[model samples]
Target: MKLAAAAGGTLLVSPNFAFAGEVDNLSIAWTTDTASWDPNQRLSPDPQTILKMVFDQPIDMTSDLKLTPGLLTEWTLADDAMSMHVTLRDDVTFSDGSKLTTEDFRYTFFERVNQGEELDIAVGFGTVSDIEILSPTEAVMQFSKPSPIVAQWLSFSASYVVSKAYAEKVGPEKMKTSPMGTGPYVLTEYQRDSRIVLTRRDDYWGDLPSAKQITIEIIPDPTARLAALESGTVDIATELSIRDVKRLEQGGTLNAVTNPIARIIYVTIRADGVFADRNVRLAAHHAVDKDLLSKAFFGGDAVTINQPTIPGMPSFLPDFHFDYDVAKAQELLAASGFGPDNPVTLDFATTNGQFPGDYDIARAVVTMWEKVGIKANLTVITESQWYELNASGKLPPASLFVWENGTGDPELFAGNMFDADLPFATYRTDEVTAMIKPLLKEPDYDTRIKGYEEFNQYLIEEGAMIPLLQAIQTIGYRNGIEIKPWANGLIRPEAITIS
Candidate 1:
């Protein structure tokens, strides 16, 4: 799967500092900082990883994405499957030494559902009707219908519990900087866009971490992060491009590991503006060669997608895919009444290094569009700026976006991006909105598959989005440092050791 060439090759490897099996303090260079300290506010890998340190959800998922207990000791579902009962671990306590109770679970779930309009993870709880406390250590969560997947949704990081009393005393605004949870790490300092420092709690309920102090420095540029790793300043770096991985691994002072995640890096076109014409959008889709892009930018490590779903996912329809055809694209452009003299121009927005080789891929796509008589103007912005534009509905007609569904559920992708009420949705229409109801309400497994099939068919035929490729999570670490990488590209601080 190695595809990218060695980058500039200018970074010099320094001598190793820590001896084998001597991990005490560790520093990691992450591509982005937490958008919010409150666990339920934002949904992304960096923020989720940070929240996992300070907060613990009632349930957690294994690497294979199976549901497991975190704060809860046992769970039971009614025979009808409409209600779920879980018992909390009375021994679990927050960093402040307050015992965790069922009331904390009620407060977090209710708050998330009430603020569903602005949160991405809210889609997971669509069937949840109400949560009732049975006792101090037990509670019941009722759903509108039988939802077999609700337990897995509860394991998501967005469901991480916070102390109701602590949140009430501090208020929502203060919680953004200071959060209270029952995880193994205590956040001591958080500097916006700079660094976040956490210390291991002496009384953590689980096995103690090998490192006592953890520092996460935000370095947006991929090259700068690699340089820091080579200079012995940083022990681990995440989101490295395939090229950087090749260079670092070849240098022999560092090790690189790549894991394909449940994320799709694709392009979204706003149907209301420059892409109002269906012919132009379809033409642009056919103009770019996804296979070539996967090889050139990703070094063949990425999976080229035709529809929203990735290859290994259950809902992926291999029969329906868009192939590269220059002649077909030119014919579609001609039918649109736009030619070389009257080229259809579009503003393309993307980030520099948000993903692996993002800038290069964007430029390459623009060049491919130019060949089909479409002129695309490129705008490279920061990750935060891109999110802001999308949230405000000010994004350009065509923009690059990534949807990472760590749960590996088909509904997470279809519901979040197409559901009209959700904050992350981009394109909205009567046809797409109408298709969302059956997908969510259908309780039968076979029937749900049919709903997704029909929904994907509509999206492909209507060209709702131009599918690109699934990103591979690549981690670069200093030699002698052992770190476990999560399936969602999260580098957990508790899993690191010097050896």
Candidate 2:
């Protein structure tokens, strides 16, 4: 904590007292993204960075986190992979010294689903009623209905098993301050809205690190984050602007890398807004050249995409592609009664100062729309207020939002967003709800994939949500740390090793 005044009592205090362990030759600089540092509260990429320190278990993308062999290894899948029975890995224990058990998995899922903290993945397991504990180390997970994706959902870190004993002992609010997970790092200190410190657990079940202690300081300014990364104060930074891509170009020990980010940024139309008209929507789609905006704004790191899910992932239907069509766009608007006399006026709420040159992109979009007779009003908000407004679901006028679920499963991606019950866009669709019901129940992989492709196509063709650019996830680090590259930006923390 640092003082505000020249001599003292008026100190503008911070949470982390100091970095844990010794500062090593290789240090990582990253920003604390959210207002808080609770793992359960983490819904964005920022939280994931910190979560790596707090949890040591490696994820096996090849198997479901549930009923898999890890902290809790080996499980029984029924005749179909739909339901599973698993046994915990023996001898695993929490930092608090509670033995790992089936109850941990059971309670964690039940808690998150009820709390709605990490429902992005938990929605797949919504059918499971209870976990039957046959013994301390063993249990059976019976689903209300068979779900092939249950394991995939469980594989997410959010569904990670927590020590129920510690959680109850710590209590909810207290647990936020003192989380005990079976990871490489132990939560040592957390200052609300400021910073957090984690120390490598020497007694941790899995392999830890040569670095020893990891401190995550919550720096909101991406520029500030970049500065820290360059100045040797930080070892890694999250969400750097396209300009920073050039900043690192001058060359240093620092390196910048990009991944096909799970995040797909798109424009959302308010179901109740003026864009509710189909022609108004499709015309608006064609009016903006996504390719130009992505190139100018993202520095060639993004692809203009139409599918609700990421490209190359399961159930991704490349059948539909959206491109600029000026003539057809005008015709669609004319057919739908939207004309220059009664121009389609759009109010778009996007960010300008947040990312590098975001305002320019917003302006470019408005300019494109104007040629087709759409009067676009773009309002810029700071990143904080933007998210606050987004969380409220009343996306001001129109809004630009990004979704970053890296599971590579289309059902979870498209189904989670467009699915009426949990439309993150805040738009509701009866057809979407109908489409997902059968899709979720199909047991055959081929059938499921086919159904997913069809639903994604429908979402695109119907303009359920405006499609925009897909971001390649970028992670900049010093040369010492190693990262495994997957099409998805998510790196299994367990697989990471510092050289």
Candidate 3:
């Protein structure tokens, strides 16, 4: 039962355990609980995982990163590329027995986040001008300019369709606790931060999942999650400790899987305070020994990155590289007119256990920077406070965070984090904004890719953000539990099946 890394690092059966047909319910313990069930409200990984089960997207991105029909049977792009015609699947109906219509798509895309709703998906949608319903089953997504990645945006979990009727009937606050959608599972109970229980929707429009019930038990401690999975109390555990992964592989009783995810573990530098100077930022970037950090903190589960965009994406330049050179970092710091006498002192903010060993990673980064004459004070904050500071543009000097390009396209990454005046953006310059503008309106795919390549390289050279590594996603599962891994690092419980 030794799992091969080439085979997605998963094992189906364990020699120590026997396959049981009575395993009709799948229980998963995760480190982070979902923030909200309302699709548009939060962009965290766990909530998006549950949203995918209870709601259907207008389109779906396959494991191989191809766009496929989900609720929409077919979709076509206009010649100008400013608009797209989407044909909905008339056979699909919401969990509330409401027929899925173009109106639902329109409301979900255009109006759901309007009236001052603080939705992150609004940024994902970019500059969508309007969603005009041509018929009950067809609609047109009109953009002010050519939107090259509109389809990709619609395929995002935040763009998952909700019954406009159900939402208006229940109101926003109530909808967060109780949601109705067209996917294979329905939220039966939600005890925030404790557990979420979902029951299989027998009358779902899509193929029913083999597991009749899915329980997402929130176990914040990684050790506790590993214990639960090893004791057979839980079928799966995510965010597993590196030590646990090695033990599972050696024992050959449980399956440990690693999916190279699209998430980039990078530091977002605020364009204020001591980090306002590009030279100081570049000095800090050079101070990071990405190789050492990945090995020490990530346990060989991560790949070091040099740019804001991650590898395996559309416009990633595979050959572009950055190496750690303490001498070069010191030179850059001295060149920036800062040395031991007037050292660059900054506070680094990060969330504890938000990502795998994030707190320790922050400490490691600070130690590395101190060698280059930059003094960094570490401030561990709660997840909510970290996000609040980032949103309000009050992130101390550098904030340790992971930005996931779930659409498999780098455009979303650029638009949300690099675009000028956007919420999460820290290094928003006219030049960077100009580079990202073409991704929205560029007609040729090659040209769009070229734009992103240039944009990412420019950011890397300018040290717009400190690129760390691709956050490797690990899954621990009991024997006979077969579940496909998602590249975006979300756990799709509906796709789980027992053999």
TM-score of each: 0.89, 0.85, 0.92
State the lDDT of candidate 3 residue by residue for 1-499, as single tens digits: 1101111123211111232243457888877666777887776655677778788887776654556667776777776677888878778888778798988888887787555577777775646788889999988888877877777877775878888888888888987778788888888887888888888888987656677888988999888889999889899998886767878868879998877787888988876788778889889998999889878976776889898777778888999887688888888889988866678999998888776778888899998888778888899888788768867877788889888877768776766678776666877677777777767678677777888888888888888899998888878998787767777776665446577
Q: Rate the local accuracy (lDDT) of all candidates.
A: 0.76, 0.63, 0.77
RMSD of model 2 against the true structure: 9.8
Q: In order, what is each prediction's RMSD in angstroms?
A: 8.0, 9.8, 6.1
Which of the predicted structures, 1 or 2, would earn the higher TM-score when compared with the native?
A: 1
Q: How do the residues 140-175 of candidate 1 rate in per-residue lDDT, one tens digit apiece?
A: 888887765566567665778889889778877877
Ranked by TM-score, top first:
3, 1, 2
Error of model 2, residue 330, in angstroms: 1.9
Separately for all candidates shown, the number of backbone clashes (residues 3 or more apart, or on different chains) is 2, 14, 0
Clash count (model 1, backbone only): 2
Show the colliding residue pairs in model 1: 3-299, 4-299
Q: Show model 3 residue runs off by greater than 4 Å.
A: 1-22, 114-116, 340-342
Taking all chains together, the TM-score of candidate 3 against the true structure is 0.92
lDDT score, residue 220, model 3? 90
Model 1 stretches with alpha carbons more than 4 Å out? 1-22, 74-82, 111-128, 144-149
